[model samples]
Target: MEEGLENFVPLIKRSRGYEELEKDVIDSGICSGCGACAAFCDRVGLTEDGSVPASECNMTLGAVKCNIDGICYDCCPHVSYSWGGLEDEVFGARREDELLGQYLKAFAVRSKDKEVLKNAQDGGAATSLLLAAVNEGFSDAAVVTGRDDSWSVDSTASKDKKEITGGAGTKYARAPGILKLGENLRKIPRLAIVGTGCQIAGTRRLEKKFLSSVPKAELTLIGLFCYENFPYTRLKEIIEDRLGLKMEDVTKTDITKGKLHVWTKDGKKHEKAVKEFADLAPESCVICRDFTATFSDITCGSIGSDEGWTTVIVRSQRGMDLLNAAKEKGYIEISDKVDLEAVKKTGGFKGKKRAKVLSEREKEGKFVPDYS
Candidate 1:
């Protein structure tokens, strides 16, 4: 066992199962829909609305009669855990930056590959890094979110460059990308995952639980900056009903500068203020304080860079190594022209929003996840 994990084993052995998860997180309306709970347990699945309890859990059904140590509850990101402990374990130090978390370097980067740039939402830096990791033997496979023809997103494990490229471009909806980790943990020794803040947190929790038996450095986490994400059904409705653009007709969708932009096959751009769709955001997002995926090795976003570049925040030596390898191999170009203030401003905005929401919830005596 990994050092310090022996102390955790007894606590994990006493952990409650899916029944408690449903009562605490799912029923409380704070489920982030990252699907970590259901990923490892076959009896537990996500409902149609993306909540848990799709089927009766084995523990709940008394099939196994095991009331404790359920991996489902233990792996949940929304469940109460020590944020500072996670920070110390992942980064070896607490973050000094109040908003952007710990980081070694930041850059505005773009992919050198023409095809990646053509298909990418912003700078294709994410795609470039994943390709570099696979080609350089940094990882054997990458888990990423991909969209169907109608722009509905799903998680996929891509083992090759061609498969990884299929996951290029951003989808504005939440996907259970961390579920791919649970599915492939035993099969793929070296793995990487690209996901949003909540998904990355769940992946970290999974790593803390299961990766002790394996080499921890074999897993890489690449996170994306996300202020909020919408459900696919509501997003589709807004596109079709509010914008009058059919899902199939829409070629691309992007959120930038506080506006949601949609481009159709006919080359017409339709847009609306992001706040106009505020009602569609899930409650889970309102309580989330992580805007830049602070727990990840690296975080990428389009917030603080030029129109065609991605802002990359390197938070660990692994992240820096992979980024430098990509740059050295001519997979990507890095520029030091990123606007640091812009990035912090956006992160501060998200932090303040989460604070306001938490205060309101506290006043109402609502359940708040123990992020501290």
Candidate 2:
């Protein structure tokens, strides 16, 4: 029993999802107490304090407490991404070249609620896809987005098998949990993961590796058109300073709203014009070019549809099957040929191409990474 396991017990208990626990443990100091504990857990826990003692121990700490195994960290609710082990071993295989093709896919799932429609950045495609997959038995669980205990407001994987599944709406932040997909691969055999282009790409890299050893049923990918990601620290400051809402006061964030819709603890709603805060997006996003997930099973965006309807690009067989099942079951409303030209007219894919070209050059040693 490491001294830090006690501290990690609280963190593990506090984490709401596997993704939340994985990404946060290292930074939260949960892994600092028992380094071997997390390593024993297979890097699922990043620090020494990340592991808790197992129950049945006769020794008393202070208050009532249960000792957890290092493996328990594997089941921790706080992980964010699946970056360790197999993922790190195959990092060299991930490249723009691998992102060139389309996998199974679907699109254009709109919510019946006008509020849900207006509240979503697209046509509520993300939420619809998860519900549809679960309903159709295509997946055992849907890992969606939600806020962290710290109010970081990142997406967390939802584990509910029924109607009460958790996860807030689409957050503007580029979610950090996408990396946790590989870790949850064992628990939730079939998963429907939602994210933007980069996240989809990163997950696909993981999916490819994981599938090589396991079955493809372990992971499914859904992509949203991402123009940018919000800076966390600055975004928090602005939310508190500009909106006059304390960080903890923020209950949830919505991307579908024409403006940024923020709900506070007091039930007061604050709306920030999306354009006004556009500059707050992360700088790394500017260098990213994948406006649409080139290799994702499905690609979604507002480019080709009305404000309330999502435009889904079904590029693969799996995507078509998922969408077909969703439509047949009446979970989603799909209308085709709504804005084929207009969707194509909304440009920015060039950024993806440019980013890919730069990455290629960097890998080839023609360009060096700029630490600054």
lDDT of candidate 2 over 121-150, digit per residue (tens): 567766667777876878777777666644
lDDT of each: 0.80, 0.52
- Give the per-residue Cα lDDT of candidate 2 at 84: 31
Query: Candidate 1: lDDT of 279?
Result: 80
Pairs in clash, predicted candidate 1: none
Q: What is candidate 2's local distance difference test score?
A: 0.52
136-228 per-residue lDDT for model 1 (tens digits): 878888887888889888877778677788789988887877655656765665788898888888878877775565553368899898878
Q: List runs of model 1 lying over 4 Å from the truth.
A: 1-11, 58-68
TM-score of each: 0.92, 0.60
